[model samples]
Target: MQQQTLVNFQNFIIATRDSGYKSTASALAELVDNSIEAGATKVEILINKVQEQGVEQYEVLIIDNGKAMSEDELNLALQFGGSSRFNSRNQLGRYGMGLPNSSLSQCRRVEVVTWKKKGEFLSNYLDVDEVIDKSLTRLPKPKKSTNCVFSIQSKSGTIVLWKKCDRLSFKYLKSLIKHVQFELGRVFRYSIWRGVEIRICGETIRPFDPLFIGEGVNLKGGLPYGEELHYQVKIPNNEKKTSVVKVRFVELPVQEWAKLPNEEKRKSQITKCAGATILRANREIDYGWFFMGDKRKENYDDWWRCEVSFEPELDEVFGVTHTKQEIKETEFMSSILVPDIEQTARALNNRVRLKFIDLKRIQPQVFSKQQLERNDMYLPPVKKNDGLVKKNNGSLKIKGLEYEIVTKELKRDVFFDVEEVDNCIVLTVNTAHIFYEKIFKALHSRRINNIAD
Candidate 1:
């Protein structure tokens, strides 16, 4: 009865494996994930096409230098939800839908070939079409073959060959490769950046480190919206332990960002300067949403993103769905994350609002009149009847952001100064000239350049 119940549950899960993921790329990412979790330093993916039954069938072959499985372990790996990492500590795979379910979801047959360390090779193939046939009384063991063409020479490693890929089309295959390449580059860029080599079709995959440290891009200066807000919170399950949440906002330099043309701006903006980057066990997963909540606007698409990282203990609190594609905010996580994030979001919103203000005050007059009269000194003039002319009077507007105006007057700044009050923080910004003077003087002189150098 127990075995029968297990079989039924396995069937139910396998049936639903293809539910949320839209394409083969996301499905295949699961297998790559398993390889990474298995301590593979290198992973190779190869794609091939063949003709069968008057249709072109594609096959995806993934080979990894991860730990190989024994016969019993191999059998358990194919079974749905039969994860060895279920009760283990700090593993990338816990749910166990990554191997057989993920592969069978995208293909009609999956062949897994593994060779243990200093041991013989073993191969098995599963035909999902046969398992799904209602006429079958019970599914038999996967077919074994003496011809192990998918064999690996490693002392301990695994290789998976996916055949009869019914879900993959030629067009879909191309798109899947591109999408998976980007997602894998983004999600696991750290691994690649940290010296792990990954290859696709014999070509090495370059790490896409958005922080721009790889390929000679380095971060030298301090972040634009500079104060780091750090908080200490207790881990939910482990009462004795605690987790730290820190929020620091940064805006790219206007000069550097403006060097790109309009087209580049539109394309680069989404992945720029940190948005909502969710990390588990110090590895980044999802990056940049800004919590727009379906509201679309051109301004929000500007170059700004936040990096959200947390320990793996927050996974359940973050509602890690089966696909692991996204996180559903639970009360425990939201209660802490939302409020903290909202603070940073509010700061970003203020910066955006100020940009408009600066534009309204300066654009028309400066571009039309002032630059013309000053022999194109680079500053433009505004229309006389406009209220923006009076708003700044004799101040310069900061590029990209409008909330900040460089005026001789004391009452037009819009930066927040939050002070810790009992139980909560109170924010205030009342004609604060001290900070403004300090920043302006610092940016105004040649000494600042030397300091930066």
Candidate 2:
């Protein structure tokens, strides 16, 4: 007879927790995925901070008004890879590892309480400490619990509680709450627009449309760059079924926004929107330089944007991971979409460059008006002033023609003012521009660093 061995549950749980989740926002997204897959319309996330051993810690609770699970299903749901709907492609969750893997990755203990009708509730929990000490070998059996965080107002609902959150990314409650709201707003914008209600700490979260398609949040003065493009992609391992991937392009009002302050530009995410935003099953998975072939990204590319969205059946083609945070950019993704995306990106880049040049031409005319408003008098250069002129030396040569260089200090409101007169080029800098106010003033105002202290 051959001897058989079993895997150690405690060691496995610890190793599984380190499965490369980038942030707490991603791990929480996994829980929200389960709720959406269960046909939940309303989901609420709550965070509580308390002091333990003189140190502050946080606990997270997620309540969903979805179809609740039975006692047998709840027991199986607590186990890794135990979902009855494993490998089902009709919903968001395909791999059964999302629930436990995501919960345990951020917390030391996870408890689930569910109910089917009023006055009847069941609960199950898993604690890492108990597992490591060998006091608990498996998930606790579902039993009656009156301490459930969610009230049984609906016919069916589930509540997931995470205690001892030691691996959360944010240490403060306010930062964590803000991060969650922003991330979820983008990740589930499509679903939220379609009537899903998501709330955090009693406040509703509004959808943030990355495409700027005018739902509630959109790019200022944004317009469609081109018509929507559609591509038929064959699902991997299933040739009979084809998935339609939609590609759309949007261009921001660069002419109107290029002059914005650095802080305002950063807040608008204008400079950061340089590449394509990839959406899997209507949720944004990743955003980067994708399927652009060999074309390199340029600074001017930030004025325009692209979006690639596909169904969940093409997950393998896009190389979507179980974490749902990133994509692998496999060869299949490149072969089907690279050619068109690269061509479109180049065309958009040229258009933006021309717009910027056109805008530059108008700036000189606008600045001329500001120049006329200054009433301060300025002294003209004296005629035949030898001190202001310097003879051309052998070291000075321009296009094989040597010329004398003249420099003069002009008291104007501009940064640079240049002119050519009497076979000599004059270079003058104004002292009234912001370049002088912020930079020149700061540098010259110091009195030799207080005479070296």
lDDT of 1 at 187: 68
| lDDT of every predicted structure (CA atoms) | 0.59, 0.77
Span of ten consecutive residues with least summed lDDT in model 2: 367-376
Model 1 earns a TM-score of 0.69
Estimate, for each residue in 257-329, the C-alpha lDDT of model 1 and write its tens digit: 4333333444543223345667665455455554444334345435444566665555666666656666766
TM-scores for all candidates: the values are 0.69, 0.79
In model 2, residue pairs whose N, Cα or C atoms come closer than 3 Å (at least 3 residues apart or on different chains), thus clashing, are none
* lDDT computed for candidate 2: 0.77
| Per-residue alpha-carbon lDDT of candidate 2 for residues 286-373, written as tens digits (9 for 90 to 100) | 8899888888999888888899998888888888887788887788778878899999999999999988766655543222222322
